[model samples]
Target: MSTSAPEDFAQALAQRLGGQSVRQLAAVSGWGRTTVSDIRAGRHIPSEAQLRDLLMSVGADESEIASWQERRSAIITPPAA
Candidate 1:
């Protein structure tokens, strides 16, 4: 398997959540079809607000959501101890 990573959480989530063929994001706050689609396609990046909402939509708790938000830019590098 290739070690190369995918673009971002949005892409990964979309894949895990299934169906890139659709353009609807019903329960995710402030996120309609276009925003989700753009993020998944890597055509655009999501804002902090959008990121948090995405996590909540996917059944993630506040802690997980915070972790995802706090480390979005840090995903490219490991954090120091």
Candidate 2:
């Protein structure tokens, strides 16, 4: 998989939000607004489960969720020398 910057991943997740408010997404995902806001703002990279919940709350299908997970992984995992 290709590497992705943290900001790029955050931007892609925000786009998936499709104009939904942080409060709304947090409610649907059973998380706090600040958590959602942080994730959207690239200030946080959530755990895998949290990411799954956030993606699902935004209506992301399994494939989409997996894609996001991959992107997140790319950002966190270091490249080989």
Candidate 3:
């Protein structure tokens, strides 16, 4: 994966969030707005558990959650030599 993978992941997540604001997502996910903002901005990449919690808080279906997990995995896992 390229260096921009995290940004791409964040952009896709933001799109999935649609019109929801960072504050609203934070309230629903029990996370601070700054955390949400950082995730959305690609300044922070949440752990698997944190990502699952955020996705579940937004009522993400299993397939959607899986897709996000795959994306997150792609970012964290390096390409095989």
lDDT string, candidate 3, 14-56, tens digits: 7777677888888988888999888878789988876876888
Q: How accurate is candidate 2 locally (lDDT)?
A: 0.87
Give the poorly placed runs of model 3, Cα more than 4 Å off: 1-3
Residue 18's C-alpha lDDT in candidate 1? 59
For all candidates in order, the CA lDDT equals: 0.62, 0.87, 0.84
Determine the C-alpha RMSD for candidate 3 after optimal superposition of all C-alphas: 2.5
Candidate 2 lDDT trough over 10 residues, lowest sum? 1-10
Best first by lDDT, ranked: 2, 3, 1
Report the C-alpha displacement of residue 75, candidate 1, in angstroms.
5.6
Evaluate residue 30 in candidate 1 and report its C-alpha lDDT on the 0 to 100 scale: 54
**Residues 2-33, model 1: lDDT tens digits:** 43333655556566445424344544455777
Best by lDDT: 2
Model 2 C-alpha lDDT per residue in residues 1-81, reported as the tens digit of each score: 764488777887888787889989999999999999998887999889889999899788999889888888888989999
Stretches > 4 Å off in candidate 2: 1-4
Global CA lDDT computed for model 3: 0.84
Error of 2 at 51 (Å): 1.2
